[model samples]
Target chain A: MSRAYNFCAGPATLPEQVLLQARDEMLDWRGTGMSVMEMSHRSDEFVEIAETAEQDVRDLAGISDDYAVLFMQGGASSQFATVPLNLLGNSASADYVNTGIWSEKAIAEARRYGDVNVVASSAGCGFTTVPDQTGWKTRADAAYLHYTPNETIGGLEFDFVPDSGKVPLVADMSSSMLSCPVDVSKFGLIYAGAQKNIGPSGLVVVIVRKDLLGKAHVKIPTMMNYQVMADNASMFNTPATYSWYLTGLVFKWLKDQGGVSAIGELNARKAKKLYHFIDTNPLYSNPIDPRFRSRMNVPFILADEALNSAFLKGADERQLLNLKGHRSVGGMRASIYNAMPEAGVDALIFYMAEFAKERG
Target chain B: MSRAYNFCAGPATLPEQVLLQARDEMLDWRGTGMSVMEMSHRSDEFVEIAETAEQDVRDLAGISDDYAVLFMQGGASSQFATVPLNLLGNSASADYVNTGIWSEKAIAEARRYGDVNVVASSAGCGFTTVPDQTGWKTRADAAYLHYTPNETIGGLEFDFVPDSGKVPLVADMSSSMLSCPVDVSKFGLIYAGAQKNIGPSGLVVVIVRKDLLGKAHVKIPTMMNYQVMADNASMFNTPATYSWYLTGLVFKWLKDQGGVSAIGELNARKAKKLYHFIDTNPLYSNPIDPRFRSRMNVPFILADEALNSAFLKGADERQLLNLKGHRSVGGMRASIYNAMPEAGVDALIFYMAEFAKERG
Candidate 1:
């Protein structure tokens, strides 16, 4: 089977090895006579699968004992509302750092539950960079500070973690988690939708400090309540088992490649190679601030707007797919997630250079 | 590959054909060069898949243009809150018929949003039968009447659809959808969790009257808003694409086998064969009211409680898996969904008679 390099920001490309493993095990998982999707969530077979997936995620993230890993549904967008519903217990407010579309969405959802302080915003600069955190006007008694580590749409990323002082830091690492190494003890909670770096679209991985459990407002739905999910080990309902299983396979693949640090080095190299081509080539340009360009999603615009379609057409002809940028930020984006090999990056760079030379 | 008969109530048994097809297409679907799970939801490929799935469901259910079909996530449990949040509008109350565990849970969640009128309740009868609709205490101004057509745990199903005149009728048909033929226009809305009969656990199908759109309370999350989902054709967020695809295949299979009418006949025959064995056998009995016995889920008990373990063990030895009943009512439950062939029912009946005769 010929598979293209899928650069879609999410429901993005997964490790080919993981796909092959899933295909092999689709009918029977490890002699369990049933497909993972058919196994009861409560059964020993599924329980082990779920546990191993959670454990592997924890290992990859270097999650500490203080943090509880949750496998949840409804994607990261649901968590935009659930995070506030669970974290902002009695407090009437929270601080938000608006870096791009995703961060702005988090702030808007949080406003439904409490007062939101726009502690830092790059909106004034067209979401090209992360605003200076020192300028943030944080509330003294705010429940927590929320931010998106990588803005998938704008292709902007935070180069460093923000210091929240006494306030708990919550990061929506949907597009960036597992692409690099992170200090687990530094944040109160980190959540990522598994589509990009982890596995599939339906499952979300959440790591929250244990102390934050059981503090959700009574109004939170049982499924959205963190403590209940934590107590039940993310089996409060039948999870997306197939996605979780795929995630487990992806996690195993990550370990085989020498864990997160090793993958991080490779991801950085892939990002640098692609960025260097875009920088040297006059026919294409990436507008994000140099210090904050995302390693995962790289959005670029054509020198000639009319050539945008031709560029995408030429790329598609070469089997480089999903490079069209988000409609909200129209241009082009090549998301190079962990599953994307350096070879795929090199192929993309070669294609870009060839396309530029022909156009020039 | 050897496969076992999985008896999970939800995330339960799937047609072997679907699994085989899914495995074959795991890498490339119809030469698309990408798995259904990896395709962008907005891409023409996925859009075609989603549309075909919806069209097949409509054909299977005989749904008309007046009805809107929506595929959503978070299972039917999320809809417990979303249904009330959407339909309640300016109305201060809604009517809920409490038949068993699922309905009771739905009532509890709905109570958080508006006053819930317990129109009828079978809890007094230990949830073994549907409460008489004539005795219902529905409010005159209730925005809608909600009911679960089949209770998976209690193995009780409504014998007749309740007549609500102008009051919009909403039914959670999670366990019984596509198992029988029903007049689609008779009810204002119908929702089902896919695991049991549709496909897998993550996808929830909702059919609503067009007039019900846009009434969602301002506070409801966009993911939960029926209007938003309907407007976007259930692509408001990244959907459970693989599950949706599987459900589409299941729908095609059902259509090929002469749609719901033929399946319903088979389902009835299966239920009768199993129930007749329990009724006539001195060593086994089913306590649910015969009038309300579910054609999908058949729960029974061993007359000699001590032999329950032996019964389950023998069934396991014979490969009659998942025959063990729900935890709340522990004895045995044989869920005969659309996929369970008549031969499976015959095998189950033969085993039950053989085990009963030997034990007696």
Candidate 2:
């Protein structure tokens, strides 16, 4: 069997080893006589799988016992509303840092629940870089500050974690989590849609500081209540069990690769190699400033506009799949997520050089 | 690969054909060179999959164009909250027929959204039967009538759809959907958690009459809004894609077996055969009234209570898996979902008879 290097953002590439491992166990898991899909969520077998995933994630992140790891459904978009619902508490306002499309959506959803103060915004600069922290107007009385560390659409990323002072820092890390090392204690909460750099499309991994629990507005749905989710250990209802199982496999994969720090070094190298090719090529140009360029999603444009379609077609023919950029920015993007091997990056660079040489 | 017949109540049994089909395609789906889990939801290939599943469901249920089919996450428990948040429009109270634990939970969740009236309750009968419709105190002013057609834990099912007059009839068919033929036109909405008879956990299927749209309260989250879901065809957010694909396969499996009607007949026969053994044996008894006994889940108790542990152990040794009942009920239950072949029922009976003969 052959596999293509998939670079579509969000529901992007997964480790081939994990997929093969899952395929081998598709019919029966550990002599259980049924697939994980067929096992009850309350069963001891499944509970062990869920608990092990939780412990592994905590260990990978060095997450303190003060934090709760919730394996939830409805993706990160759902958390746009869930964050405000669970964190706004009795406070009248929440502060938001707008970086790109993802942060804008989060800001808009938070407004539905409470007053939102735009503490920082890079939209004024055409989403090219993270605005300097000194220009921001942060509120002391605000419930929490929210931001997206990596904007998958425009390929912009924050190089530094914001200092929230006394306020809890909340971040939508959908495109960036588990890609590198992170300081768990630096944020009040972190959330990610598990389609990118994680497992499947429908699940979300939410890590909320335990102290933030039980403060949701009385009217929010139980499924969206972090406290309730934490209390139940994220099994508030039948979770996306299959996704959780796959994610556990992924956590083990990360561990086998020497945890997040080692993966971070490799991820940095992968991004550096791909960007080096794009930087030196006459036919290709990456628009974002070097400081803010994302490692996971790299959106590059062609010097000759008409070659865009041909470039993508040629890439596909060569079994380099899903390299088309986001529609809003019509060019080409190779999202080199953590699952992408360095060899895949080398292949991408080889193809890009050949394409540029032929076009030039 | 040896496969066991699993009788688990929720994340219960799935069709072996579906499992085999999924296993074969796990590495490369339809030569796309990527697993379905890795494909973008907006990609033509994945969208075709999502559309085909919707169409197949509409075909299987004989659903009309006036109804919208939504593939959602968070299970039936989330829908307990979603139902009221979406359907409790311009009415002070919603009516709920309390049959068992599921209805109890639904009633509690609906009260969080609006006034809920227990129109009829079988709780007085220790949840052994459904309260007759004639005794119901259903309100004409109610926005809708809610009921669970099959209670998985209690093993009671409503054999007839409740008449809500002008009020929209909403039914939770989680454990009962696809097990029988039903008149979709009879109810304003039908929803089923896809674990039992459909596919996997985490995906919930909702079929709603189109007119019910545009009435949800403004405070409701966009993801939970039926109007938004209908407008987006349930790709309002990235859906449980893999689960949706497997359900499509299960739909095809049902169609191959002559659709829901034929499956309904087989399900009835399976339940009847299992019930016959329990009824005839001096060592066993089924508590639920025959009229309310679920076609999908059969809960039976042993006359010699001390033999319960031994009965389950022996059954497991004989390969009758998950015959252990709900934790709340504490007896034995065999969830004969659409995936369970009649041969499985025969094996169950064979074990039950031998165990009884040895014990008696």
Candidate 2 regions with alpha-carbon error over 4 angstroms: none
Model 1 misplaced regions, further than 4 Å: none
* Alpha-carbon deviation at A251 in model 2, angstroms: 0.7
Worst 10 residues of 1 chain B by lDDT: B1-10
| Candidate 1 CAPRI level | medium
> Which 10-residue window of candidate 1 chain A scores lowest in summed lDDT?
A235-244
Can you give the lDDT of residue A117 in candidate 1? 90
DockQ of each: 0.66, 0.73
Candidate 2 CAPRI level: medium
Q: Which candidate wins on lDDT?
A: 2
Instruction: Give one digit per residue, the lDDT tens place, for model 2 in B144-227.
Output: 999999999999998888888899999999999878889999888889988888898889999999999888888888888989
Q: Fraction of true contacts kept, per model?
A: 0.60, 0.67
